[model samples]
Target: MLAFYPRFIRTFDDLPGQLSLLIHAWNGCNMRCYGCHNADELIAKPPKDHLSGAQVVERLSGYDAMFDAVLFSGGEF
Candidate 1:
């Protein structure tokens, strides 16, 4: 199984028609839900560890030319 990261790029094997990248927005969430699938990792993240929105945008821009679409993934974008 794939270990999840707060933010990273992944290419899908099942998506249709175009080459896409999946980017997990961050390592945390604030809304606590019952039986949360990813709450453990989300809540435990240090606020200082992830990139800012501007940083994410700058990084992905380089790959936008190569990918058909960029999917921003995570609890909240």
Candidate 2:
């Protein structure tokens, strides 16, 4: 199983399709629905740990040439 991270960024090379950056927007959720995939992270993440807009952009700067699209993931905005 893959361990979750609040700002997880990943890329897949073997998969067919446009190259993309998979970014987990946040490690949080507003509901406690049964069997949620991120249940553990939702309960464990601290709000203060979330990255600011500038930080996210900085982190993604190097990826500009690496992907053809950005796929944002995570629950809640």
Candidate 3:
């Protein structure tokens, strides 16, 4: 894993009526797709405030009831 910070909670308009939590679990990328918005940050250095896998799961578990689905976002999968 590149980096992790699981304390954040965000809602996105996926398809007008659908809303989901956008999980930002990692940073930096290897693919480097053209015109990607995260290219700058991904190419730079990984964040120092990242979390561990167990911590990520624990943090996410706190908001389990608030959302029906999750979206693993940021950089590569």
Each prediction's whole-model lDDT (CA): 0.59, 0.59, 0.63
Give stretches of model 2 more than 4 Å off. 1-6, 11-16, 31-35, 42-48
Which ten residues in a row are the worst by lDDT in model 3? 37-46
Using lDDT as the measure, the top candidate is 3
For TM-score, candidate 1 versus 3, the one ahead is 3
**lDDT tens readout by residue for model 2, 10-62:** 56652457776765555454566677665565466544556655676777887
Relative to the true structure, candidate 2 has a C-alpha RMSD (angstroms) of 6.2
Taking the tens digit of each residue's C-alpha lDDT, what string does model 1 give over 1-77? 11234466556653688787876545454456678654555556544466666676677776667887777555654
TM-score versus the correct structure, for each prediction: 0.55, 0.53, 0.64
List model 3 lDDT by residue over 1-77, tens digit each.
54665445566664355567765656655566678654555346555677776777777787778877777656566
Tell me the deviation in Å of residue 19 in model 1.
Answer: 1.7
lDDT of 2 at 49: 59
**Models sorted by lDDT, best on top:** 3, 1, 2
lDDT of 2 at 4: 29
- Poorest stretch of ten by lDDT in candidate 1: 1-10
lDDT computed for candidate 3: 0.63
Give the root-mean-square deviation of each candidate in angstroms. Answer: 6.4, 6.2, 2.9
